[model samples]
Target: MSNRSRANRPTPDLSDANNPHAQKAQNFGPSAKRLFGILGQDKNTLIVVFIFSVLSVGLTVLGPWLLGKATNVVFEGFLSKQFPEGTTKDLVIAQLQAQGDTNQASMLENMNLVPGSGIDFDRLASILLLVLGAYLLGSIFSLIQARILNRIVQDAMNRLRIQVEEKIHRLPLSYFDSIKRGDLLSRVTNDVDNIGQSLQQTLSQAITSLLTVIGVLVMMFIISPLLALVALVSIPITIAITVVVAKRSQKLFTDQWKQTGVLNARVEETYSGHAVVKVFGHQKDVQEAFDEENDSVYKASFGAQFVSGIIMPSMMFVGNLSYVAIAVVGGLQVASGSLSIGAVQSFIQYSRQFTQPLSQLGSMANLLQSGVASAERVFELLDEKEQDPDPLTPATVAHSANRLEFKDVSFGYTEDNTLISNLNLEVRSGSTIAIVGPTGAGKTTLVNLIMRFYDINEGSLTLGNTADSAIDVRTMTRADLRSRTGMVLQDTWLFAGTIRENILYGRPDATEEDMVAAARAAYVDRFVHALPDGYDTVLDDEAVNLSVGERQLITIARAFLANPRLLILDEATSSVDTRTELLIQRAMSKLRQDRTAFVIAHRLSTIRDANLILMMEHGEIVEHGNHRELMEKQGAYWTLYNSQFQAPAQHESQTDGDHI
Candidate 1:
């Protein structure tokens, strides 16, 4: 097929009703207004931007008017010579004189001598110079405006990103638990970036376009009211088309950005788990999911771009039609001696100028709407409920005594389905308390409450020197409550940093000697010396460079360095082999020596020597005793112990997905 033939073929249907990006619809106006409010915070810079923009636009608006004067000077002489039917040079001169313009009439008569191409070089040069000067000033002002706006936009975006970063810490862990990491990442990075770029491009341009539209219309009316009215014919039509098309494209633009975020999420998740996908032979499934997301993004972007692309051409068509009508009417008025030839030329130029800003504004509206959508997403994140408020006079623990008491504590992820209810416990300072249970028991939930990760739904959890004299945990701030606590979880987390750095994170001000002592205590130094860089070895993404045991050792070292009054170790050695498990057990023995600790373990062997053991089932402790006492009872604890030794493999397989 020829190029023309292919071009003539209709565009494909790019809209998708079933698209994931089409989940929600929003209004851009309020978001846009809110965005403006945010910008208004930097009122000084905004005022300066507004001043430069006005100066730039005001200077540009004078170009056509001045050039029109020069054109009128040249044509006044020539038109007088080409007198039509009843309209003569004498008649025009008489009319000018009659209007008390003797000085202009005298100038026209003098310039008529070289009437064939009667362009007064002196006067034309003067007008051209003035036009050039105006244009130059306009350009300078525009450059200044752009630079200021870019600075303002970058500053605003920086503040926005910082706000999001700070908000993360203030938000409840439950919010993060429910939301995806990739989505939050997109909000902090991609969404904020979209707003920055769009604002940088649109702020000055939108203002200039609006100002130009108004300025051009005013000039047009001054030039010829009759021709201005003709140009006005398409104003409502152009606006109507822009408004209707823009409203439809607003949703499409929002979908496009939303798909962009979704696409980012898919890429982030896929790449992060690429090895798992390949190992499990699930590459095809992953690819299929990615393809579906990619296609949705394409369709949404195409629909948005195609619809927004309509505005420019539609406005151009209306503008051109208006131009033609103005030209015809101006010519008639000129022929009837009601308007000057130069005035007609200026009116036509102004008409083009008028439509130019309208078209520009139409295009800018699309970008503004998209920016607002991103702003709304960002604003939504900012509006999430923060962690409970801090107390006016927060409770404090005496350095010597940090006893914890749970009196009728109860909580659940939701209120209707309570996971732990009517629970009570008392823990002495500097003692190890083992919480043991079958799979699905609330052992871990109990620890989470102790750390204040979740507040109790009922009753009072207090901390003090003695159980009876304890102050409610709620009276103390979360930061203060968690500060003296140390935790090591089943899954070890190490960031992309040196072994020393990860350890130092637990106690940033710890001395080098203290760090080495903690590492030695946790047996981390045993393996660290074998690595090429010793303690300075940098971990890769997710710390995959280290073995599971090595990573667990690093975490134990972290806890040891913290040396907190309270320690919570949850399945710290559950997944390691026999040798590594023994190494971790030794470290645990050292760390738990004389420290107030809550140990949650699946392997009953690790907790056999715990000072006190509470065997939990469902949400309550079914049996409580020392290891020997529980073993003698031949109850839940005895059955779980016998089962672990009887079928170790079966026990692990059955409890693999257990919450506790």
Candidate 2:
């Protein structure tokens, strides 16, 4: 894809019900279900959680009914006209018996009906206490449910994070080449974080809301079926609005996160190359690009929020309509003596409870969709094609034998485009071969192949002597192959840890004495003693505390500690100063003594004493000879060497002419 298309692609509507991606998500279903399946691994915890949730819902549902009983106690006490002031209990009982109102008499007796109008405060108190206790118990269960669910969610997230880390190690280097570091980091950090947060906050609420709706509906039906039907009138309408808005909002959310990824990439690029941006005075352009991405994210977010924001108010309007219908119909029922006043009150509460959860779920549509999008990205990364699967019943190769050859090797970043073709090379055991090439001459490509960072599409790379049929390198596990080789790249990488930890990275089992010896060999000890913490000094993300040359030396010390049978150094000293380069060269020479080393250097003067010189261009070795032999031929190697050695003198003469 061109940079223009990459930067300016229009935001997609991921929420369109007809959108393929959205439909695909529906087809595959939410990752939440898969996550829940992961939770199924702990069936005991799930059962306990389910029990608590049910207990909480049952207690909550019983509250309104218990409260209605209290209301009836107060209502009947105030409305009883049969008991007039100064009327005796015997007269009231006789009057009730004459009227044949046995049920009313029983209710009056149970209430401890006073001659004068008054409420049964003691009974009211008892019912109120029961209501309070039920609520308190319900809250306790709710808390337990939340805590247990949190444990399950966090444990699942932890497992997912570990899997992602392991998956990264299993992926091929080409995967990293095609993806931005920031984008990949976002998947592991931001995307996974999204999933965890959604599960923690939304998952439990979703369950509770669903239970509340069901429990409320049942209560509403029990009170008065006619009024219950009135309340049910809004269900289809609210669902209609929810589905329409959710679909549209889903698309917006996907675009929002896509823009977020772009913005992250922009920030990473600008910050990592801040010096270059300033040097070229391209700060304006960089800022403009960032603003574009930032604006896009803002717009996408606004659209998503605007659409999702409609769910609550729309549902509220529908809920209020339902409330009106229920109240009017319930009042009629009460007036006709078909329903008690207390029942009417309880039914109204249930009606509201029913709508409350629907509103909550409607609001959650946005969160659910966003979480789903993040999960899709994360799952995509997890499901990516890994480096060639480890052979079943894997085999190991012998160490300390570094005779290597590449036969008819053909490879490329993409299959259709072959960069290296029909390449053939052989190196004797324990020989130092220096590779000299210009920019984009496939220098590092060759080194990468040697390290098996990439596999060739055609032909074979073999180790051991060809005399008795060579052993194909692919037969051995990648870990075993790389363990016996040490590499020092031009771009030094050090983790944020103590200097000692970074040095010990190469050989974790190396002793302190061995670490010190390797540091001294690489000349890293010279600067280590100068730092305030000596070997304990810490490094940050950029490792800015150490100079370029200092960082390079530490990496060299790392390679030295590994003491591999084969060494690959790709422009190891290219970024250092003259004095530091000389020191690094001396260190490398010592390290390369017994190993078969492949050194890629642009400086022709540094490899004069190499056992063999392979001058490469356009993925092919154009010349092969030692210094004197190549000089005698005056070919490509000769031209490259003189260009470097004689450039300064040629510039001096040009300057002299200009002065004259």
Best by lDDT: 2
TM-scores of the candidates are: 0.88, 0.91
lDDT of 1 by residue, 36-152 (tens): 887787899988988998899989998988988888777754654454445555666788899988756665553333323444678888999999999999999999988888888
lDDT tens readout by residue for model 2, 1-660: 112112211233433566332232331265657656666776898789888998998899989988888998788778554467888666786787789876555445434455776777899999999999999999999999999999988998898899899999999876766566666777798888988887787878898999988888888888888998999999999999998898888778767766676677678878988999999999999989888879998999999889989999999999999999889998877655677778889998898888998999888877877777677777777877899976776665567778899899987767666767899988888889999977766777787787787888899988874435557878877888888899988888889998899999999999999999999988889999999999999999788999988998888899999999899887788767898788878878888787899988888888998888998877788998788899899999999999997999999999999999
Best of the candidates, TM-score = 2
Q: RMSD to native for every prediction? A: 9.2, 4.7
The lowest-lDDT stretch of 10 consecutive residues in candidate 1 is 1-10
**Candidate 1 vs. true structure, TM-score:** 0.88
* Model 2 lowest lDDT segment of ten: 1-10
